[model samples]
Target: MSDPKSLGLLAQFETPADIMHAAMAVRDAGFSKWDVFTPFPIHGMDDAMALPSSKVGFFTFVGGVTGFFSGMGMIWFMNKFDYPLVVGGKPLFTPLFAFPVSYELTILLSAFGTLFGLALLNRLPKLNNPLFSSERFKRATNDKFFVYVETADPKFSAVETRALLATLGASAVEEIHDTEA
Candidate 1:
């Protein structure tokens, strides 16, 4: 078997601008497995990273449509076939009467879709990450910015990646290894 492989190399930056520039360079260098961490959301980072648009809206739309149709079907089955009811000679299945319940189900299922879609898409509930092992990385949530390029990338080379990060003005560069590896 081969030796354990590295997870990636992490470079710390003093400011958002520094991290942003590093991300662009990494992207342009044809590195697909890289990420940037910031204390808070940074505007234009999406464009710099070349990330794709989220598909959560598609999930919500599907959920809403399913809810509306199911609501209509349920009302029709109950009133028209299961047990026909005549109150003051009203129609068995009236769209006017069904509107309220249909609207409610549409909102409810759409919400469920949005919640579950986000969780699944983001791979949520991840209790741990290797990056958390670094004491310096803890500052990422407070004030520091970071850019990391994984060794799994096609263009990754430990020495060359470190050199590139240094050239981009990284304050500190550190290699991260996978504990399980």
Candidate 2:
């Protein structure tokens, strides 16, 4: 018997090639809700997996633009409109003075956006995971490659999925116990 809380079923692959092959197989077989884990990214895996273009770049773009505008606004407010003061006989709104702080703030905000956006997009900050308790999952960060078909997926069926994995050269298959949220 498997745990009822299982979120997905994991199938292990011995090599990166096997995982990539399985990715293709899964996509062609119309299993869209599957994820593959590897020690490192394999080239062309996304195509095989049929993954869509990521919006991470968009997040970065927004963050950068927001940072730039925010920097410009702050500088303008303090130096020009809000509290204009001539310093060293220079214009109240000196682009040179603004450039340094604006540049620095832009870089800083973009960096923060990258980190925070990635986490938010990935739904991370995961304090706990059932996979951690599973003896089999520990190898994910090490040498082995694995694929999982989430139960939330409409196409998920343990028996059929296991067979599909086996046909794709899965070395081993196991159930994941998804706990209560």
What is the C-alpha local distance difference test score of candidate 2? 0.82
For 16-92, candidate 2 gives per-residue lDDT tens digits of: 88898888888888877788888888999889888887767666767777887788889889889999888889887
Please give me the total number of clashing residue pairs in predicted model 1.
0
TM-score of model 1 (CA atoms): 0.89
Each prediction's total of clashing residue pairs, residues at least 3 apart in sequence or on different chains, is 0, 4
**lDDT (tens digit, per residue) of candidate 1 on 1-181:** 1365578889999998888998899889989989999999999998899999889998899889988888989999999889998878989997888989999999999999998889989899787898887788999999999998998898999889999999999999987867666
Clashing pairs in 1: none
lDDT for 27 (candidate 1): 87
- Taking every candidate in turn, the Cα RMSD to the unseen true structure, in Å, is 2.3, 1.9
Model 1 alpha-carbon miss at residue 37, Å? 1.6
